[model samples]
Target: MLKILKYSFYEMIRSRWIFIYSGFYLIASMALLLLSNDISKVLISLTNIIIILTPLIGILFGTIYYYNSKEFIQLLMAQALSRWSIFTGMYLGLAAALCISILIGIGIPLIAYGVLGSAELSLFLLLITMACVLSIVFSLMAFLIALKFDDKVKGLSISIFVWLFFAIIYDGIFLLLLLGFKEYPLDKLTISMIVLNPIDLARILILMKLDMSAMMGYTGAVLSKFLGKNIGMIIISFSLLLWVILPLWTIRRVSMKKDF
Candidate 1:
């Protein structure tokens, strides 16, 4: 596993897209810093970027890598390597490369600005945490989906649609439901809705870190009121964790049953 992990990590780190992904973050971070010399504002901006880009990048990167590495995967499978080691290693390695990109891309600017010691420290950490979580969650989802479909085009399309559902359409449906049922009690329903969508859960987490629950919308406000800050954060964090784990577990199961 470690050997496969090292190889996967090295391969992913050396990929052209990894550099592009990290470069984008670096440029964005620098631009945000120049525009607003406040670390808090920078963090909030970064959070929004992470929320949007992480899933898109992860979905694309994971599926593309899985398909592109088909030959490599088959070659490894012919060897004595366990499917578990080969696959989980690739997943972890990809996730690690993404984490590095995020850390260096955003961390450099925050450190250079010398705002690491301010009250925004916690928010900064939370932003990084959520970004990393989002990366792994969607990337693993991509890998699992790719494993399920034989055709690259089909796998890619499904992965993208899955992302769209979670990242955008899910929110739209939630809003519509709320509007359609404003006359009914929706406190618990609201919490359930946000909890079901990882992106929304992430937004709530960051909003809480920014201490701006008012921006959390109706569902978020209800969640905040019911669970309060501390408990709500714990639950949201746990939910995000499940989002990360479920895909990884699915990847393992699917890889185990499917023949290369």
Candidate 2:
């Protein structure tokens, strides 16, 4: 397991795309902070960009890496290594690499700009938590895509569409339902809706801390009223965890049965 992990990490570290992604994130972070007059605005903008880009990059890069490394994986499989070890190692290694890149690119800048102080601790926690969630979601998506589709284009398309659906279209559908049920108790309903979408939960978590939950309009107010308590927050956090774990477990199962 350790050997497989080390090999996977080395492969990611040496990839040109990793450097390019990190560079783009770093430049964007620096530019945002340098240009913004308000620290809060800077943080908000940075968080939004990170949330959008992190999962997309993670899924695309991870899937491509897995497909490109097919021969290497097969070579290792020819040895005595277990399939679980290989799969977990690759997943963990890729996740670690992406996490480190994000930490360096966005985390460092936020910290440097005094975004890690007590006043901003909750916000910082949200950022880190969202980053972890993004990595987990995308890593598993990549694995699933690789397992389900042999063509690189098909796998990559699946990843992008999945991201888009969850990130954008899912919210649109939720809004449509909310509009259709105008007389309902939206606060509770909004909480229930959040349970279905990790991206929405992430946005709520961060924006609530930023006191921008109101920007969500009526739904935001509803969530703020209901999810303002410690217990409410805990429940939502657990829901987010479920979002990460379920797909990952499914991916693991599929990978176990997958032929190299």
Candidate 3:
């Protein structure tokens, strides 16, 4: 498993797409920080980037890597390599590659700007943690989704659609529900809805650290009451942890039964 992980990680390090992803972050972070000269605003912009782009890239890269490694994986299996090791190694390898890209891409500019010594250091750590977690969560989903559909095109489409649903449609539907049932209480329902979408869960977690005036808003009140400050953050962190575990477990279970 460690050998498989090393091969996959080193292989992806040479991948052009990973370099491109990292470069994109490098250029964007530098521009945002240098141009705006405001760490707070740069962090906010970065949060949006991490929340949106990281998951998209994670899922796409995971699926493509899976298909690309079909022959290699088969060769490994022929040599009696365990299925879980192959899958887990590949997943961790890909996830690690992404984490490195993100860390280097954004870390350099942020540190150069002296984010480490600032009071916003914890917020910076939270942002990076969520970015890594989000990457892992989506990559696992992409792998499991790829396994479910042998057709590459369909697999890719479903992956994008799942991302779109969580990133966009889910929020739209949640808002409509609040508007449609404006007279009724939706405190608990709102919290339940956010849990169903990992993107929203991440946003809420980071926003808690930001402590914006918007935190005094309606949804914030609902979350505050239901999740109870510290407990809420713990639950969100635990939930993100669950998001990573469930899909990998599913992949292992399914791989055992299927002749991959």
Candidate 4:
């Protein structure tokens, strides 16, 4: 397992796409920070961009890499290695590569700019938490595409739809619910709805860190009520952790049964 993981990690680091992805993230992060006059606004804009773009790129790049590496994987399979080892190694390798890139591209810059110290610890925790969630989400997405779809185009198409649903459509549905049930206990309803969408949860978590949850109105109030209290924050954090775990478990089951 160690050998497989090591090889997989090194292989990913050597890839041109990984470099390109990291370069793009670094440039964007720096540009956003340097261009903005307000630190809070810069953080908000960068956070939103990272939450949306990171997962999309991660999923797309990972799926493409897996499909493109089919020949290499087949050769490894022929060496009598266990399927689980190969799959786990590949998944971990891809995830680790992206995680490292995120740290370098975003984390380092934020620290260098002294942005890290200005934000509350809860905000930093939220940023790290979101990064973890993005990693899991995209890793699972890559696994599903690799295991189920033989065609690269089809796999990519599926990933795009999945990203769109989580990042855009889910928010649209939440808005509709808000409009339809304005008279209800909207605060609780807003919290419930945010919990249903990982992206929204992520957005809320970061915004809360920025002390910008007030901008969300009733939904913000619920988030504030939940995150403002110590125990409630813990519960919300654990719920986010569960989001990371469940999808990976599903991917593990699917990979195990997959013919590939």
Candidate 5:
């Protein structure tokens, strides 16, 4: 497993896409820093970008890497490697690679800007944590999704659709439901809906951390009333942790039963 992990990690690190991905974050972070001296505003802007882009890239890269590495996977299987090790190692390798890209891409500029000594440091760390968690959660999901389909085109299509649903459609649908039932109380429903979608969960977590939940309107009030800051943070953190575990566990199960 370790050997497989090392191979996959190094192989991905050598890829030009990883460089481009990391470079994108580095340039974006630098640009944000240059545009605004206000760390809070910059963090918010970054939160928005990371929430959307991280998962997109994570899942896309996972699916593509899965299909691209089929030949290597076959070779590993022929050598009697354990299915769990192969799948899990590959997943970790890909996820770790993405995390590194995120760290490098976002870390350098912030460090250079002396965020480490600033009061906003904790918030910056939280933002990075959420970004990396999203990367792992979505990439693991991509692997599980890819495993279900042998067709690369079909797999890629479903991957994109899954991302779209979670990142965009889910929120739109949630808003429509709220508008349709504006007269009725939706506190419980609103919380449940946000908890169900990882992207929404992440956005709420960051907004709360930013101390901007007042801008969240009724939903924010309900969250604060019901969960409070500490409890809400705990719940959100636990849920995000499950988002990582459940998918990876499913990947292991699926790989064991999969013919490939």
Candidate 6:
């Protein structure tokens, strides 16, 4: 597993996509900081970008990597290795490469700006943490899709649709529901809805950290009013953790059972 992991990690680390991904964040962060003296404002702006872009990149890169390396993957499967180890190692390697890109991409500017005060530092860490977790979760999802479908086109399409649904469509539908049923209490429902979508959960958590719950609109206020910040963070964090774990478990199952 470690060898497979090292190979995948180093291989992906050399990818031009990783460099572009890292460079985008670096340039965007620096630009935002240059434009705004307010660190919180800069973070909120980056949060919007990270929350949407990270998962998209994760899925795209994961599916492309898996498909491009299909021959090598098959070769590895013929070896004396556990399928679990092979898939898990590959997934971890891909995810680790992404997470590091995010860290370096965003971390440099935040640190240079002296965002190291207790409150600001925690917020910055939370942003990076959420970005890393999103990368892991979606990349795992992409791998699972790739493993399930033999056709690269089908796998990549489904993977992208999954990202689209979570990042955009889900919110649109949720808003329609809120509008149609604004007469009743939806605090619990709202929380459940947000928890169900990792993107929404991450956005809410970051907004809370920024002390900009008001910007979250009704959903944010309800989240704060009902659960309070700390408890809400715990629930959302656990939900995000489940997002990572469930896909991983599914990937393992599919990899073990598949004929590959």
Which one wins by TM-score: 4 or 5?
5
| Alpha-carbon shift of residue 54 in model 4 (angstroms) | 1.0
Local distance difference test, per candidate? Answer: 0.86, 0.80, 0.87, 0.76, 0.90, 0.89
Clash totals, every prediction: 0, 0, 0, 0, 0, 0
lDDT by residue (tens digit), candidate 3, 1-260: 99989989999999999999999999999999877977878999999999999889989999999889877888988877888888888888999999999999999889989999998899999898888888888988999998888889999999999889888999999999999998998887888788867888888777767876265688776776656677766777677788877897899999888876
By TM-score rank, best first, the candidates go 5, 3, 6, 1, 2, 4
Model 5 misplacement above 4 A: 227-230
Error of 6 at 57 (Å): 0.3
Q: What is the lDDT of residue 231 in candidate 2?
A: 83
Per-residue alpha-carbon lDDT of candidate 6 for residues 90-143, written as tens digits (9 for 90 to 100): 988999999999999999988998998635788899999999988988898899
> In candidate 2, residue 52 scores what lDDT?
82
User: What would the TM-score be for candidate 5 when compared with the true structure?
Assistant: 0.96
Question: Better model by TM-score, 1 or 2?
Answer: 1
Candidate 2 runs further than 4 Å off: 214-218
Q: What tens-digit string does per-residue lDDT give for candidate 2 at 116-178?
A: 664766777678768777877777778878878988898888989988988888889988987
Q: Between candidates 2 and 5, which one is better according to TM-score?
A: 5
User: Which residue pairs does candidate 6 place in steric collision?
Assistant: none
| Residue 196's lDDT in candidate 4 | 66
Question: What TM-score does candidate 1 reach?
Answer: 0.94
Give the 10-residue window scoring lowest on summed lDDT in candidate 2.
Answer: 116-125
Q: Per-residue lDDT tens digits of candidate 4, residues 1-260? A: 67888888999888888888778768877898789755567667768777888778877877887887787888888887887787778878888888888877777766677766674445655675587677667766777776788888888889888888888988898889888988777777777777767677788778777776677676667778887899877766677777667766776787677665
Worst window of 10 by summed lDDT in candidate 6: 224-233
Distance (Å) between predicted and true CA of 225, model 1?
2.8
Comparing 1 and 4 on lDDT, the stronger one: 1
- Alpha-carbon deviation at 91 in model 3, angstroms: 1.0
